[model samples]
Target: MAANKILIVAEHAGGALNPSTAKCVTCARAIEDGEITVAVFATDGSSVAAQAAALQGVTQVLQIDNAANGHPLAAVLAPQIAALADGFTHVFGPSTTFGKDLMPRVAALIDTPQLSDIMAVESAHCFRRPIYAGNAIITVKVPADLKIVATVRTASFEAVADGGAASVEKRDVQVDLPTHTRFVEISAASSDRPDLQTARTVVSGGRALGSADGFRILYSLAEKLGAAVGASRAAVDAGYVPNDMQVGQTGKIISPELYIAVGISGAIQHLTGIKDARTIVAINKDAEAPIFEVADIGLVGDLFALVPELEKQLA
Candidate 1:
């Protein structure tokens, strides 16, 4: 395609830019040489726009400041993004809840197929993604005539450092606001631990943890190691942790430097989430557990006894 410019839909909340946007920029860099522009939509996006402008490879930051953008409703935001997508060959977003909900709408409005969870950039028109819950990798080539709309898997790429001096430009798009969807109060789980998607270390528990109280051990170890707390789908279904803490194919995907799985039975669904982790440590009583196959370190023992000793040793 002659148009080499790429537009990234920035992910941000509470006036701060989410780290995933920088990762999307990294993915964009893997594509052919082009100008990278990050688009921020918010009531007061100046703060997040400034952060987006600092991403190492970004060429420009487009700020769409409007009260209607305070809560990113796909119905409302997609039209604006599609409008800004003019003259750009690629439009990118992070493969996150925010991106999952937004990008498809933008693609539909622009009459193009949306590529989800792209893991690699083979070329400007070709990409790689995971299928069958990450058990298989599939490469796809987009039609040269269509503008590419894709959501990049943030875990597969590292975020670019904050060093660029990309210029910030304001855009005023005119679109009809949808009355069917409106912003409502958002209730987010508050925690002092690192974000699960971006943490360097993660300590996760499974149904074997038994109860919510059983998760306290994992929390203790996570705190000692300055890690995020994660839970398998089984643990979340068993009510051991909130759904937000789930780490699996049906939950959040993470690629931490170190992943410590305690009492997890290693379901394929769960493995998909941590497949990109640099190192995996499996702690389960069953020596034949599927997790042992992929773990860099394996310990066949009772977590109840092992976790406490680990915490004490670290202490």
Candidate 2:
């Protein structure tokens, strides 16, 4: 693997592009601002590749079209990606589920040292990242000649703005896929609400709400503000909310324009996910809850009483 140009692998599902790919492209460009190419793998990578090309700072999109790659994974997509990686200086990806699974296979396949969850690029081979559940930040570097493979933290970089007149090109690569990981039906959530991972505003509930019904405070507040719903680890562990809504060290990290924490006792783990939020608002019965330390707006009151009042006033 040679390090001459940075290559980003575009991720998608069912023909639609994932915004993380745009964010990854932005991140990669910020790191080196060098010649950048994106590879999209699918039954026909044409659509997704074109979408990648529309993003700013992208040189071109390489499409790997194959029947076997209709549904992509390491057993399938890695080979196509590996074939392209040898010609690049660096290979970057979003630290997503797909990237989490893909980078390891690529590293093993290409036999190069891979970096994960990098938050900042100090140089072509140097980066800053979080560890200890984001309790600490660490910086490290790699050799320029090494195949620098990395999974970038999405929020650390902005997504490329739309309307860039980037050009897309097609590639003819043979995708040999293994027969594994049955493709089960894809189910969309019933609610028309925005995805928590990408939403700009998030309203979270905590265990102070005694039951699942208590969690509706988030939904109500989120609806009023057109925000996404989130939950504390205690709320998820107690079955008052789904794990998808959990925001903590083990949960998804989000950097929204605003975050409202309802009844959540501030835990270091919980703070790690939401610390980057532009503004933090906390409402808890305990006036001295740790969440207040980081919250820009603090409300100490009974959530049951104050929440409905807030919904009424905002309405």
Per-residue lDDT value at 55 in model 1: 91
Candidate 1 versus truth, CA RMSD in Å, comes to 1.1
**Residues 84-163, model 1: lDDT tens digits:** 99999899999999999999999999999999999998989999999999999999999888899999999999999999
lDDT of 2 at 307: 88
Consecutive 10-residue window with the lowest summed lDDT within model 2:
181-190
Residue-wise C-alpha lDDT for candidate 2, range 229-290, written one tens digit per residue: 98999999999877778887778788899899999999999999897899999999998899
TM-score of candidate 2 to 2 decimals: 0.93
| Leading candidate by TM-score | 1
For each candidate, the alpha-carbon lDDT, in order, equals 0.94, 0.83
lDDT over C-alpha atoms for residue 159 of model 1: 92
Worst 10 residues of 1 by lDDT: 1-10
RMSD (Å) per prediction:
1.1, 2.1
